[model samples]
Target: MVTNKNKIPALRDRKAALLAFMPAFLMAAASAYVPMEAGLVLPVLGFTIMAVFFGLVVLWWQTETERQTLAMQLAGLEQEERVPTAPLVLRPPVIVGSPLSVLRELAVSASAQEVGAEIVLAPTERVQPARFPEPSLLPSMRRSSAEEVSRMRLVTQAFEADRIELHLQPVVSLPQGKIRFYEALARLRLADETLLSPSEFLPILECSGRASDFDRRVLIRSMAIARHLVARGSEAIVSVNLTAHSIAEPGFLWSLAGLFDTSPDLLGKIVLEMTQHSWRHLDADHRAALATLRERGVPFSLDRAADLRFDPEALADLGVRFMKLPADLLISVAEQSDGRYAGPELDVRDFASALRRQGIRLIAERVEEDEMVPKLCDLGVPLAQGFVFAAPRPIKPEIAGEQTASRPFGLEDAPTLLRRAG
Candidate 1:
C-alpha cells in the first residue's frame, strides 16, 4: 500500500526551543554573573561576551532553522492527511500499486509534490473486491480511470480557454546577490483568475497527452521573458521546464525552433530544464532533439531531481549544462532503518564532486534556511533557489519590452509584479 502517510515529526523541535532562548540566556548571565563596576575589565568582558554571543548566534541559526522548517513541513503534511479526498465508488489502481498504473502514478506523485502535497500512504488491498465488497476489480478500475480522465479534461479546459500564466523565480549565484538565472514556472489561471495547484491538474494532463501543449505554452512565455532580459543586457540565463511528453515528442523541437528561429539569440540565452523522470524515458527522438538544441546553443538542465535512477555522469555527457536538486532530497542527515539517508543514500558532497568533474554545475532548489546556504556552498553547489531568497513573481511588461513580449500587451499585465503565486 503506497500511502501519503509519512513520518511527520511533531511541531516542536528540541534545538529550536533552546536556540530561541540562547540570547536571553546570555543577557541574564552577563547581568547576574559579571561584575559591572570593574572599569576597563568590565568593558573587556562585555566585548568578549558579545563576540561569543554573536558567534553562537550564527551557529544556532545554522543548525535549528532547517530543523524547524522540516518540523513545520511535517506538521503541514499531517494537516493535509486530514483534507478529505473526493469520494468515489471505486478506488483507482494506484491504491493497489497496479503495474499498469505505475507511470500514471509517477506523474501524479511528482505533480502532487510540486504543488506542496505529497501522495499520502494508503493500504494496498483497496482494489480487491473481497476487501471492499465491491464489483469486479477490473471493471471498477476501468470506470475509475474514465472518471479520472473526465477530471483531467475539466482541469485541462484552462488551456483551451487561454488561461495559462508564467511565474518567475530567481536562482542566485552562491554568496553573491546577483541573479544568475531565473526559472519560469507554469501556472494555470481560471476564468475567474483563480489558480489551481499543479497537483490538482497535472496528473491527468500528462496522462491525456496534453502535457506537451502546456510545455509549449510555457516555453513561449519564457521566450518573451528571455527576449526582455537580453534587451536589458541581463547576463542571467532564463530556464523553462520541458515535460517528458514534450521531450519525447518527435516534432516539439521543430516547433520550438520555428517559434524562436527569428531570434536565435534568445534561444542561446534560454536553458531548458527537465527532471530526472523526464530524462529517464528519453528515446532516440529525445536525444536527437536535445542534440539539435545543444548545437543551437540552447543548453539543457535536469532540475529538481529526487530520484537517482539515472547516471548523472551519463547525463552530462549528453550536453546537459547543469543539474538542480531539491535541498532536502540532496542533503539529509536523517538515516533510514536500512541505514540509508532519506533520499538516494549517496554522499552528496562526493556525488556533487563527481558531477562537477563532468562539467555540470550542481544547483540546490527549495533552499529555505540560512544554514543550508553554507552547507550547499561547502558541498560545491554553486547555485540555490527558493523562498529563502525570493518567491516567484510576475514579470512586468515594461521590464521585458513589447518587441520581446510573448503575448499582446493587455490587461493581463495590469497587476504588474504582483506574483500569481502558486
Candidate 2:
C-alpha cells in the first residue's frame, strides 16, 4: 500500500510536468508535422527554451526568499535595539536589574547591621553590586526638570501675553537669488527682551500640548505677512509651518477655514508647511483636517524631510505644492550616486522633474555655503532657502503685530540682509 501511495505522488508530478510542457510540445509538432527528423529538432529547441525559463524562475524565487528572510532578521534586530531619546522625563532610568533590587539591598544591609555579626561571606564568583543613582544627582535632575517646566510655562505665558514674534527667511530662486517666498518662523520674546527661536521653544510647546495654539498664531501672522507683501505689489508667498498636533485638534479646520474666510487672497499667497515626521504620523482625522483645508484652497509644503524618498503623485493628491530638502543633503546624495540613487526607489536627478510634473516645486533649504548654489542648480532645484542668502529677519513689529499696516514695505524693508543671523 505504501509503495502504491509513493508511486501515485510520482505519477501526479509527471502529469504536472507534462501539462507544463504541453504548449511547447504542440508548437513543435505544428512547426514540423511532415518530417519526423525536422520535428525532432523543433521539440529539442522548444524543450531547451522551456527548461531555461523554468530554471531562471526557480533561481529568482530562491534568491527573493533569501533576501526577504535576511531583511526581516535585520528589521527585527533594529526594532529590538531601538531606544527612545526624547523628553528626558519620560525616559526610564538605566538599571541593569529590577528596581526592587535596590530596596532589597538596603533592607538586607540594615538587617545585617542590626544583627551585629562580623561574618565574612566568601564569594564563589565575583559579581558587581547593584548601582543606584546618587542622592546629589537627584537634586540636579529635579532642577533640570523644574527648569524645563519653567521654560514650558514661560512659552505658554508668551502665547497669552501676545509676545510671539514673526520672522521671515527668504526662499529665493536658483541661478538668480530673487526672492520668491518667505518662510514664516516664530520667535518667543520673553519679558527680559530675550528672543527665543522656534528651536528653543517649539519642543516645549509641543510637549505641553500647546502646539495648536502656536500654529494658529503663526498662521495668523503669516497671512498678515502675505497680505503685506501682496499690498506692496510683491508676488512673494509666505509659507507657515504647522504641527500635526494642531491639525489633529478638534475644530482645527473650522478655525482655519474661518481665518481663510476673512482673507480670501491668502489662498494664493499663503502656503502651509509641516515637517516630514509630522506628515508621516498623521492619522485619518489629521488627514481629514488637512483635506478640509486643501479644499478651502490652502496648499501644503513638506519640510525637514529625513530622506529624498518622496512620491510625487501621492504628495500632489495630498495637496502638497512644495517640498524643501537641505542643500547639503541633496548635494551629498547626488555626489554619492551620480544622482541615480534617492532613497530605495527614486532617482535624485529625476526627483525635481517628477515633482514638477505633479505641480510640486522643490526648495533646497539650509544653503549655508555659496558653493552649494551651482550644484543645486545642476540638480534642477528651482528654489533655495538658507543663511547663504539671508537670515530670518523680523517683519517690523508694527506691521506683523497688527492687521492694518503702518506703511507699505519698500525695497529696503525687504528681508534681503546679506549677513548671517547672529
Candidate 3:
C-alpha cells in the first residue's frame, strides 16, 4: 500500500546503506550457508534465503559505483606500468675495501669483546675501519716472546668469559639478467679472535657432533643480516650453508617453519647452499625437509661443484637451479677439453651451454683475469664472482643499489659488463 514516490526514495536510501555493509555480510552469509546446506538445517535455509535476497540487492547497486571507481584506478595503473623505464647506465666502478677482509683483520687484531663492539658498530658504519688500536710492537718485542703470548692468552680468556661474539660472512650476489642477488655464505668467528672458514670448521663441527649448534648460529645470524638488508630496500638473498648433521636432525624441518612463521617475506630470499658434504648424509626425512623448503620457494644451490662427488644431473633432478664451479675447474677444463672454436676449451661457454640445456645456471667463482673474461662470455656463464669482479664487500644499501642497477641485459654483454658491474 506504499505510494511509488515514497517507496522509491526509501528503497534508494536502504540500498545505499546496505551496499556499505555488503561485502562482509555476503562473506558471513556464504560461510554460514555452506555448512548449513551440507547439514540440511531448516533454520539455515531460512537465514540463507534472506541473506541471498539482501546480498543481491546490495551487490547490484554497489557494482555500478565500484565499477566506475575501479575503472579509473585501473587506467592510472596501466599508464604507470606502460611508461618506459630508462636502462641503467654505468659509471666507472668504485673501489671499496672488502668487508670480509676487514673482518679477517679484526679477528687477528682484536679481542672477542672488541669484535662484539665492532659488530654492533657495523650496522651504523659498515664502510669505516674499526678503531681498535694496533698491537704494541715495541713493547711486545722488548718482552720475551713467551711473555707477550701469555698476555695475549689471558686477554682472550677474559673476553671469552663474557661470551659476546659475531659469526658468519655474508654471501652476496652480482645481479644477473632476471636474477637479483643470489645468496649468502656463513663464516664463523672463534673465541681466540680467529676467523674460521667454513671449509675448515664445518668438517670439524660435523665430526665433533656439534654441527646442529653451528647451523643454528649461522641460520639465526644470516637471517638477521637478511632482515637488515631488506629493511634498507635491498632484495638480496642470504644463503646459509647447512651441514649433513644439522639437516638430518629430527624436528629440524619444523624448526625452520617456526623460524619463518613470523616472517614469510624471508622464505623466498633464503637460499640453502647444500654441499656434497651435506647431501651424502641426507635421509628420507631430510629429503622431505628439502622438498618442503622447495615448495615454500626457498631454492637450493649446489656449492663447490668442482668436487667430483657432486652429480650435476642429480642436482638438477632435485630442483637445484644453480651450481658454483671453482676457478681451478674452469681453468683446468678450458685448458684440457677440445670443443668448438677453442684455443683453450672455453669452459664458461661450453659448461654454461651444457648446464643451460639441463636448466641450471653456471656460476664461475674466483674469476680474476682480463684474459679469462672473453672466455666466460663465450661460455655464457650467467654469473661470475671473483676479485676481478668486485671483491666481497659489506652489503651496504647504496652499493647494493648500484650493483642491481648495473646488471647486464643479456649474454652479449656478459663478459666485460659482468666484471665491471660486479
Candidate 4:
C-alpha cells in the first residue's frame, strides 16, 4: 500500500509536468505548420520545432525536481522532534507602606528624639478642681454673626486706619501709542510704611463678605484720583475692579450714576473691569442693572477672557466692549511655533474672532515676553498688558506721560515698579 501511495504521488507529479509542457508543444506545432505551409526549408523548420519541444521538457523536469525536493524537506520536518518551551515565571509584587504611615512613623521618631526622655507618672496629689470662669454671655458663634462681626471690624478699621491708599498703575498703549488709561489698584500701607499688595488683603475682604464695601471705597478713591489725572490735562481712563456682589446690588447702577454726576469728566474715562466669575453670578435682574449702566456709556471689559468656562457669547450679548486674555496663553503659543500665535496654540482665537466680528477689542493681559508682541498683533490682539509692556506702578506724572512716551513698554519694568504699587 505504501509503494502504491508513492507511485500515486510520482504519477501526479508527472501529470503536472505534462500539463506545464502542453503550451510549448502547441507553440512548436504552430511553428512547424506555419513554416511548412509557407514552403520554408524543411531542415530549418524541423530544427526549430525540436529546440522548442526539448526546452519545454527541460523546464518541466526542473519544476518537478524542485517540487520533490520541497516535499522531502517538509516530510523530514514532520518527523523531527519538537523542542519543549520553558514555563513562564511571574515574580511576586513588592510590598510598600503608604506615604501617610511612613510620615507618621518618621514624625514619631522625630518627636521621641526631640523629647530626649519619657516622663514617669507619679501618684496624682488630691486637690479640689478649680472652678472654670463662667462662659461669657455673647452672641452665638454662627456663620452669619461671625461674618457680620468680621465685616464690621474690617469696615471700622479701614475707616479709622489711614493705611489704605489708592495706587494707580498706568496701562499704556501699543508702540508709540498714547497713555490711554491707568488701572486703580488698592494698596495697604502697613504701619511701617511698607506697602502690602491687594492680592494679600483682597481675598480676606471677599471671605469676610465685605467685597462690596471694599469695592465702594476703592471706587470712591479711584474716582478722586481720576479727577486729579483729568485736571492735569491727562485723558487717561481709570479702571476699577468690581466684585460680583457689587454688580448684583440693585442700587449699584444708581451709585455709579451719582459718582459720574460728581465727576462728570470721569464718566468718559472710567472703565470697570467685571471679572468673568463676577459676571456669571448676575441673574436676570442683575443683568438688567448692567444694561442700565451700558446705556449710560460706562465702558466695561471682561477680565480673564481666556477662561474656557467664561461665556464669551453671553458677554458679547451683554455688550462687553473689551476682553482681557491671560498673558501665558499668548506667550506659550509664541514660544512653541516660530513666534506666531495661530492654530491650536491660539486657543481663544475662536472667542477673539467672535468678539471682533462684533467690533469688540481683544486685550492680551500679562504680555511679558518681547517675542510675543508680534504674534499677539498677528492674532488681532491690539492691546497687550504685562510687565513686558509696563509694570503697574504708582502713577508719576513724568513716568506716566514721558517714560511711556520715550521707551517702548516692556515686561522687565513690571516687577520693579509693580511691586512698589500693586
Candidate 5:
C-alpha cells in the first residue's frame, strides 16, 4: 500500500553485492590456500598515522555512545529531569565601570530582594545534565581566515605598542570586613583611558600564539608590584591570571625564578589564577612547570568553576588552594528543585567541607548585591569579590608610599612602629 516508497537504491545494491561476494571472500579466507603455517594476515592501508586516528575515532564514538546511553538510563531512574523546564538565567560578564554593568547590578539587586529569589532561580538544583559540545560546520579550525588574521594583527600591535593595562579588583573576606587580595584583570587601555574587555583581544592573541607576550607582560608587572608590596610591608597578596597554555613559557618561568631567587618570601604571597577551560589546552611542559611552582610553595587558584565539567577532586589533586565561583551560580545551586532552600543544604555544606579537607577555599565572585551576602555566608563561602567590595580600577601609583592610618603600619611605618614600641 505504501508503494515501497523512500527505498534507498544504493543501500539495496550494496547489500545484494555484499551478500553475493562476502561469502566467497569469507570461504577463501577460511580455506587455507598455501601449505605455509602462517595463521592470518589482513592487509592494512599504508597510511599508518591516518589509520591510527581513524581507529581512535571509532573507539571514541563507541565509548561516547555507551556513556550517553548509560546517562539516559540513569535519568530514567530519577523523576522528571526538569519539571516545568526553566532556564537558569546567568548574568554575562560585563566590562567593569560600563553602563551595562550598572544596569545589571540594579536588576540583580531588585530580583535578589524578592523573598522567593532562590526558588525563582532554580528549575532543578541537584545535578546539571551534561551539555554536548557544539559541533562546527568547518570540521577543523582555519587559522588563516581573513578575520583571524586581522584579529591576530590587532592584538600583536597592541602588545608591541604597550597598550595592555592591568586593572585590580579586590577580593574581600566575608562580612565585608577586610580586603584579602586583589585580582589582576588585563585590559586594553584606549586613548580616552577607557578599556577593552578580554573578548575584544584575548582570543586574537591566543589564536596568533602571541598570548605568551601578554602573559609575560602581566607577570613582570605583577612581580614588580609584589616587590613593591614587600618593600612597603603589605601582607596582601596580588593574584595574577594567565592562560594554562602559557604556563610553561620559558620567559615567564625565567622571570618568576628570578623574582623567587631574590624574593623567596613573596612566592607564598602571590596567587596564580587560571580558568579550568584553559587547562584543557595544557601539555606536558605546562604540567611540569606547575609541578615546579607547586614545589616552590606557589599555590594556584581555580576560576570559571560553575559547570558540571568542573571536577573538584581533580582540581584538589592539581594543588589548587582557591576557587572563584560566580555568585549567581552558587545561588542557583543552593535553591532546591522546588525552590525550598530554607536551611543550608547537606550537599553544599558537604562540598564545602570536602574542599576544606583538601585545603581549598571557595570565593564567591560577582557579589553585586547585599541580598546575596547572607546566602553565600550560609553556604560557607569565606571570601567574595564584586562591585559591592570594589570594581576593577587602577591601583594608586604610590602603592609603596606611606601607609594610611586604616592600614596597620605598612612598609614605611613598620620600622618606626617597632622603634616606638621599643
Candidate 6:
C-alpha cells in the first residue's frame, strides 16, 4: 500500500528517463550544427522527444499526486473512526560500505522529500534480550550434596562396623516360577539397624570408590552361598553383582583368582553379574580380567540391562550366559513397536530366539505383576524375577553359618529353604 502511494524513483525508471534525455540532447546539439534541410529534421525529432518526455513525467507526477491525496483522505477517515494508530517511524539504515549504503542514501533523500508526513522518533538503543536468572539448581543442589555427604558418612561407618548383610532375590522360570538363580545384593545395616537397599547405598559406594569393596564382600558371600548350595547337591546358581570398578581393579581380580583356585567347585554355581553399561564399556583390561574369570569356569550375567538391544553372539562369546532386563521394558518394547525392533529391523521375538541360539538366556527382571508373565512368555522370554514371584529375602544366618553335614539341597527343596531362611 505504501509503495503504491509513494512515487519512489526506481532504478529502471531513472535509467529510462536518462536514456530519453540523452537522445533529446544529442538531437538538439546536432540540429545546431547541421544545414537548414537536415537541421529541420533534427530539431523536429528533438521537439518530439522532449514532448514525449514531458508528457511521461506529467503523467507519473499526476498519478502519484492522486495516490497521495487518496491515502491522506483514507488516513483522515481512519482517524475520524477513532482506530488506534502507531506512527510508522523509519530508522536510518546503518552506514555499511557497499552498494547497500548507496541505496540507503537514496532512500533517505526520498523520505526526506516526502511532504506532510509526521514521524515520531524514539531514542536508538540496542535492545538487550531479557536475561532470566539462569535456571538455578545451585541452592537445592547444594542441600542435596550435603545430604549425600551425610549418607556417605553413615555408609562408611556401616562398612567399618561390618554391618553389611547379604540379601537374595530369586530369578525364576516364567509360567513355572521355579527358582533358577538368586541374585546376591548387599544390604547395609546402620547403627539403628536400618537396612539400606542397594538402590540407596550402591551409588554412594560407587561414587566414593568403595564399590569394589562392597562387590568383593558380596562376591565372597555369594561364593559361600553357592558352595553350600552345590555341596547340598542343589543346581541353583547364585549370581553376585559386580561393578566395572571391581573388574578393572587388579587387586580385586587377584583376590577373585585366588578364590577360584582355592574352591574350583564354587565357580560353576557362582555367576558374576554386571550392568549393561559396564559390559558395553569394558576396556581391554576389563575384558582380559573377564576372560580370565571365564576361563576359570565363572560364567557372567548382564544385569540391569536398559534395553532389548543385544548382540547375543557377542555376549555369548563374552561368557554372558544370562541377560536380565526389566519385564516392563520387554512388554513396552514389543507393544510399542508391534514386536519389531525399536532400533534395528529385527523382531522382538527374534531377539529372544537369537539369544537362545547363541546360548544366551533372556531373563526379564522386575516382573512385579502377573500380567507381565504372559507378555514375556509370548515374547519368548524364558525367565523373570520380581515381587510377583517373591520379594527378596535375607539368607538365614544359621544357613550361611552352617558348617555341619550339608542338608541335602535341591531344586525341589529351594522354596522350603527360602521360606525357612530369614
TM-scores of all predicted structures: 0.56, 0.60, 0.47, 0.52, 0.54, 0.61
lDDT of 5 by residue, 218-255 (tens): 76677667777778787878888876435534455545
Question: lDDT tens digits, residues 255-345, model 1?
Answer: 7766667778786688888877667656677677777777777778997576544566778767788888888766673222342444564
Point out where model 4 deviates above 4 Å.
1-159, 248-250, 306-313, 333-353, 395-422
Whose TM-score is higher: candidate 2's or candidate 3's? 2
Query: What residue runs in model 3 are displaced by over 4 Å at the alpha carbon?
Result: 1-179, 190-192, 250-254, 307-314, 339-350, 357-359, 393-422
Whole-model lDDT, model 1 = 0.66
Ranking by TM-score: 6, 2, 1, 5, 4, 3
Estimate, for each residue in 93-117, the C-alpha lDDT of model 3 and write its tens digit: 2322344545565454455443333
- Model 2 TM-score, all chains together: 0.60
Rank the models by lDDT, top first: 2, 6, 1, 5, 4, 3
lDDT of 4 at 342: 44
Off by over 4 Å in 2: 1-144, 338-343, 402-421
Model 1 clash count equals: 8
lDDT (tens digit, per residue) of candidate 4 on 298-392: 77888855444454566767867777778677556545545435433325445457677776667777777787777766666666677776676
The residue-by-residue lDDT of candidate 2 on 1-422, one tens digit each, is: 01121233112234445655565566567657655575587667767688657745544544555556567778988987795332212112234233365566656556655555344435664444434432311222233565566556555665666777788899999888899989888877654455787767666676567778888878887887887888899988988987655655567756887889888877868898887876765657667877888988998899889887767898898889999988888888888745654447667877788899999999999999888899999989999999999998988877775332122223223222122225
* lDDT of candidate 6 over 235-321, digit per residue (tens): 999988776656655567657777788887787788888878778766566777778888998888898776667777788989999
Check candidate 2 and list the clashing pairs: none
Lowest lDDT sum, 10 consecutive residues, model 6, at 411-420
Residue pairs in clash, model 6: none
Pitting candidate 2 against candidate 5, the one with the higher lDDT is: 2
What local lDDT score does residue 420 receive in model 3, on the 0 to 100 scale?
14
Clashing residue pairs found in predicted model 1: 3-120, 3-121, 3-122, 4-119, 4-120, 4-121, 5-120, 5-121
Instruction: Quantify all predictions' global Cα lDDT against the true fold.
Output: 0.66, 0.71, 0.54, 0.59, 0.62, 0.70
